[model samples]
Target chain A: MNNRMILAAVAAALVAAAAPAAQAKDWTHVKVGIEGAFPPWNALDPQGNLTGLDVDLIKDLCTRAKVECDLQAGEWSAMIPSLNAGKFDLIMTLGINEKRKQVVDFTVPYASGVASFIVEKDGPLAKMPMTGEKLDLNDKEKADPVMKSIGEMLSGKAVGVVQSTSHEQLITAYFGKDVTLRTYKNSGERDLDLKAGRIDAGFDSGVYGATLPSKPGNEDLTIVGPQLKGAMLATEVAIGMRKGETELKEKLDAAIKSAAADGVIKTLSVKWSKLDLTPTF
Target chain B: MDFPFLYETFLTLIAALPLTLQLAATAIAFGAILALGLALCRISGILPLDWFARLYIFIFRGSPLLVQIFLIYYGLGQFREVRHSMFWFILRDPYWCAVIALMLNTAAYAAEIIRGGLLSVPHGQVEAARSCGMSPFMVFRRITLPLAVRQALPAYSNEMISMVKATSLASIITIMEVTGVAAKLISETFRAIEVFVVAGFIYLAINFVLTRLVAFVEYRLSPHMRQPAPLSAATVAGEIR
Candidate 1:
């Protein structure tokens, strides 16, 4: 009876020791996923190390949240599924949209951007009318004529956009019928196609599109057409989490709010993207 | 379970079939010619010709098809001379670039198959043909070529099926084949499994038809291999008695 009581006490002590660690709200360690190919956001540097705005922001956010972060690189296509499968606790550099919301929850947007088109400097599309205007895709009254003009200009021409992106959705919605759409797995490949003249124009984030023309071999490429916004093209860039992970989401959201409040996001944005993309809300 | 969505997905995937078939058919057709030439070079007595063929096969068959496609499509495009030259006209189009890559890759594998087939032709049959007073060309045409083709058919059919599937990679370079369309659908609906299931069905259907066609060709090519029909049950019982 004494031996039994001692065994029971030991078991109780072990359970007591393990329970709090499992139930603790403090996420001491986290696995975060980011598409390392997305430059100026999250990308690998010369020595094959992850570096960019998303990398920097996640580091700061994790530091402030008192959590150890293990940043992982993953393909954009695999992000949601992998997150849901518990491969990672959070995904950064995700664009918040209704379609994605159905599969994963998003933290408060840390940044926002518009989509635009890049074409060769001497290409036929260089003379397009709306070079710098920001057009809302949701405003049908404003968008129709602009879309029609774009369709006319790009008829029978091939346009490239990154696969599984808001840019692809916007291009498909607006000009899918008139122009040929080519979707690439990454922006680098799409940019390569653009420089090769295989694609007449490339549509993607205005910030990303701006970086392409300045590339060494891509000097001939230039950003043309209107800066596309609203609807599918305008999206709030945020971190993605599995559905029902409200605790992690809230924790990250708090970190983001603090980062924005302290201008950390703005500073990182300017450092990486060379523009201010700080979210107002 | 969503019959309407599956049907819609099927229809969308079907629209991309023509491009997929074109890539596969063009690659296989061109690859067969290149393979025949390479196989001949490999078997030729000259050291340089055989060495060139062996090295060509080694490099192409050594690398993954995706890497080859990327090198041809993107890597070559990086050169200013390539962009400025007349080859840009062909390289500038992703479709042609994919076709070229698929052809080159398939030709390497097919060359080995063809060479094996060529070597497998019975020496007795060639000797008999020559003894019958046939010229070298006539002997090759009448005996060696037919038997070698028959020997290579089964393996070549597998190669054909592989080429058909390989067309899916063209989507990576932005050609909207069946897989590309399915990927787009998945992106829109965020339902990867359903879209991919439909796309898989389409590929299965295509491969099934190709398999049947190859079987028919095999049947027609080998008349001597045909067997007599089986007797009916009653006839078999009566004969047993």
Candidate 2:
């Protein structure tokens, strides 16, 4: 009986030791999925590897969260499915939209930005938006008139937007029949088409538009039209986690809150996006 | 299927048809020429020529076409010299890059098919041609090439349908082909499975038409051979042991 007790104690101790080790490793083994082509957010450099703002942001967030992360570059359209399939634990650089809320959970908004139209600075449709202020799509009064003015300018014009994005939805929702909205699989290709004069304007995030001038032949392009934000733009960009990842979400949310409180977010936002994307709420 | 949306999807995919057709036609046309050259080199009796053809075929046939497309589009785009060189203008566009990858891949497979066709030309036929005072070129042009192509037609048609399916991958590089448009439609609606199914059906219809066309061509070319009629149950049973 005494020997049996001792054996039971030993087994219990061994189980306790192994349990903590696995838990500790679980926090360390983070697989981060990113859409590598979404530029300034995440993009591939000359080495044909992933890079950019989200790349930097993910490293910073993981370091702050005290986790070792493996960044996996995935095609944008398949990112969500890949994440759900357990190919990765987190999706780093996607906007927190209501539609996505049905599928996945998100951390607190790490960054907030607007979507805008990009057109040639000297092109015929350049000066038409005429509004200098960003438009909040949440308000119908403002959204209706603003969309009308934007539509008039966009009439008979080719607008390029990335597939499976709020920008594409916005273009289709507001100006479906009025304008020719061309969707691209990635922003890189749309940017190329814009530079090649195949597209009159491309609608993408303002953050991405800001980096367009840095591309080889896009020096002539400029952000035009009203910057669409708020409801139509989705909630904000956050670290997306699969639904049911409650603990992980809490951990990320806390880390994000701590980062924001420490001004790390503001610093990084200005450093990467060249603008203060620090969330107000 | 939502009738309106289905109709819209068809119209949208159809609008993108020109680009898809252009990609397939251009790739197959160029690939056929390259295949012929590679096939000849493969069987040319010269060791260097055979080795060169083998390596070319192996490299292209071994790797996934997606990797090949990416290497051509983004990989080659990485080099400063490639960007500034005369070929940069062509390489800069995703359309041409996709075409180049497709052509190269098809050429590798097509070469083997053509080579098989060439080998299928019986020794008796060549011997008979030579016995009739036919020169080598005449024998090859009339007997070998024709016989080889006939033998290769079935396999080549499979390749042709595969090429059509392969054009779907071009969407990754951002060409607004049928698959690209379908992806966009799904993104807006979030009905991925539906849109993809519709897109797949379009490809199926295209392949179905192509299969019939190839069958027609096969029948026209092989006039000397008699095709067996559709087998009745009795006929099938009679052939069984």
DockQ metric for all predictions:
0.34, 0.17
Q: Counting only residues 3 or more apart in sequence or on different chains, how many pairs clash (N, Cα, C under 3 Å) in candidate 2?
A: 0
Interface RMSD of 2: 11.5
| Model 2 residue pairs with clashes | none
Runs off by more than 4 Å, candidate 1: A1-26, A138-144, B1-7, B228-241
Report the lDDT tens digits of candidate 2 across residue range A1-281: 69977777786786456432212224667899988887778887788788877787778778888888899888887777667657888997778788788767788888888888888889887886643467888888977887888788888888888777878778888888888777677887787667656578898898888878877767888888777787757638888777777778777788788888888888887887788888765
Shift in Å, residue A186, candidate 1:
0.5
lDDT of 1 at A244: 73
Which prediction has the highest TM-score against the true structure? 1
lDDT of each: 0.86, 0.82
Q: What fraction of the native interface does candidate 2 get right in terms of contacts?
A: 0.22
Q: How much of the true A–B contact set does each candidate keep? A: 0.69, 0.22
Off by over 4 Å in 2: A1-29, A43-70, A215-217, B1-148, B175-178, B181-241
